[model samples]
Target: MKILFFDTKTYDKESFNKQLEHYPEIEIEYLKADLAPRTAPLAKGYDAVCGFVSSDVGSETMDALREAGIKLILMRCAGYNNVDLEKAEEYGIKVMRVPGYSPEAVAEHAMALALTANRRIHKAYVKVRENDFSLSGLMGFNFYEKTAGIVGTGKIGAAMAKICRGFGMKVIAYDVHRNPELDFAEYVSLDELLSRSDLISLHCPLMDSTYHLINRDTIAKMKDGVILVNTSRGGLVKTADLIEGIRARKFFGVGLDVYEEETNNVFEDRSDEILEHSTTARLLSFPNVMITSHQGFFTQEALAAISGTTLDNAVAFQKGIQNGNEVSA
Candidate 1:
């Protein structure tokens, strides 16, 4: 099977190439070009086209994919919000993804971001490096005995709950289906999670019900001076409302690995360029706000797992075997 890999990054090439040696039936040609309507035609004569979270496989792209004779769409990442699944079905293309590469990797990053934000470690690191060791603004409370609210209780959220428990924190979670394994986490309503938690971390998927889940009304329901961290989908929190909340001092510290306005900016360097129109730029101006370029799943273990699972998904498709990774509209 010949696969056209779009938006190929240095790390992706390294990891996938290493895994490719084990799969003699699979042939992948890496390209820096992203998957879009214009670029969809580039997949001609290929059995499948692989893309990441940044790839746009909308209606026009799906039409072009059909014209190119591509039958399969492989998302190397977990999230498929960028893909039009209904259009994929309409065009008779099967879509598959690596659902859980390394839940521990993302869970660990969430805790790192939460700790960095709440303790003002980012500020202290900068000050200490410049020989300005005054602890005037570095005051922070301990996480011990604090109430931590985790939004989702999937593998990742369950890992987060375990970590919070390790920190001697009281864990409360809000999810449609509670994991019985996370017995340490007290199942609660969303409103109660907001009002009760001292630190809140989002780990839920982005859907119609979950989109903009943390807007003005939700923020108003949260405890004052709550430390919030989101390592999941960016659309879950409304950016404008978050900005307003920050201005009103609603959050003690905010750590984000994802944001809605990060579409054009994620995994790219714009260091010398001006970002006058970017909400991310506005977010960077806040002292308590810390943002990373959606890299919560950047660990070596995650990369290898993603490479293996993606190839396994391809193999499943090639052999007419239905894998759990197959997603539908």
Candidate 2:
């Protein structure tokens, strides 16, 4: 069984090779390309193609893959929004993904973002480096006794709620599909969570129903000076509405690991050039906003788990095993 890994980075190669050593019988070859329609011809004779979050697998690319005789589409990450699943199913291409790698890695990053943003840690660190460590504008509130609203109760969201509880915070959660395991965190309606929470953290997935879930009306229901954190998919929060909320002082701080328009923007080398997008440029102008690229699941533990599971899924699919993470129509 031969596999063609697309969008191969140095870390991906190193980590995948190390993990795949456990299965020495399988032959794996990697191609380092964006995997669009133009590049799909590269996977000529491979049985499966592995892709990352940044790769574009639209209808054209899917058609190209079908023509290339590709049977499996293995996604290293959990989100399938970048791939057209409907078209892949239509073309008889089986899709699989690593559903949960290391929930703690992402949950920790979300908490780190919230803490850093709320306390102005980046600005304070810069000031200290410049020998101007005055206490002005560095005042931050205590996390204890604060109400934290968490959206989604998946593995990552559950971990986040536990962390918030450890900080002596009262946690309230809202999820379309509630997890019975998250009994410690009180389940509340979206409006109630927004109305009462001092800090709001989003950990939901990206689907048609969840797109731009946090818009102007939702922001209006939030507390006067709420801290917002998003380690989930970018499209969950409306960027324009968030900007307006920030300007109006409805949002005290924002810690984002993703953005609404992040295609070709995040995880790329653009430091030498001027940013052309006005929304991104404006988001960076605010002192209270800390925007990190989508790296919430970039820890070593998560990478190893993701690589191992992805290869395992590929091996299972090739061997006709009953895999749980297989994508269906």
Candidate 3:
């Protein structure tokens, strides 16, 4: 079977090639452009089309893929929020994704952001670089005796829970679907999680129900001077609510690896241009805010594993095997 891989990056090509070595019979075609309305026709003559998180796989793209005779939409990443799974199902295209590639990679990054924000490490490092060893405005408290609430108990949340435990923190979690493995964590209600946790980390996927899961009401319910960390989908937290919370000092420190309106903004060239988006600019104005461009899954190990697993799932689906990760919408 032939597979057309869209939005091919340097790392994607390297990792995909290494993984495809296990399936020599499958033919691969690489396309560097994102899967959009115009680029969807490029999947012609291929049985399947594979893409990443940034690619648009909505109704228009799905129709174009159907026209191109592509039967499968394979995502090399865990989050399928960018893909219109309902449209894919309408087009009779099966969707597959690589879930749980490296939860530790993302969980560890979330912890790094939390620590950096809470401890004011960014400010101190810059000061030290200028030969100024002053310690004002860098007073950070100990993580010990702190209460940490993880919003999702998936693989990443479980990993973060263990890390918080290692810091001598009491960990509580809230998830619609509970994991049997995370027995140490008490599965509390969302309100209880908000009111008690000193540090709250988000690791849930973005869906209709989960969109803006952390909003004004939730922020109002949270502990005062709380630390917020997000390494999950951008839409999970409402940007306006976050800004209001920060402005009121309800959030002591905000660490974000993703933003609500990050598309066409994050991981792109903007050094020579004036900054757009007043919310983002205002976010940067705060001393306790730390923002990263959605890079929690950028680790070498995670990328490699994601490519391999996605390719394997796609190949298995084509060979009439049941892929556990296949989604029907």
- Predictions in order: lDDT: 0.94, 0.90, 0.88
Clash count in backbone of candidate 2: 0
TM-score of 2: 0.97
List of clashing residue pairs for candidate 3 = none
* Leading candidate by TM-score: 1
Better of 2 and 3 by TM-score: 2
Backbone clashes in model 1, listed as residue pairs:
none
**Candidate 1 deviant stretches above 4 angstroms:** none
Q: In candidate 1, residue 177 scores what lDDT?
A: 100
Q: Model 3 — which ten-residue stretch has the worst lDDT?
A: 260-269
The backbone clash count of each candidate, in order, is: 0, 0, 0
* Candidate structures ordered by TM-score, highest first: 1, 2, 3
- How many backbone collisions does model 3 have? 0
User: How does model 1 fare in lDDT?
Assistant: 0.94
**TM-score of each predicted structure versus truth:** 0.99, 0.97, 0.96
State the lDDT of candidate 1 residue by residue for 152-185, as single tens digits.
9998999999999999999999999989999788
Of the two candidates 1 and 2, the one with more favorable TM-score, higher being better, is: 1
lDDT of 2 by residue, 214-258 (tens): 999999999998999999998999999999999998888999999
Judge candidate 2 at residue 10 and give its lDDT: 86
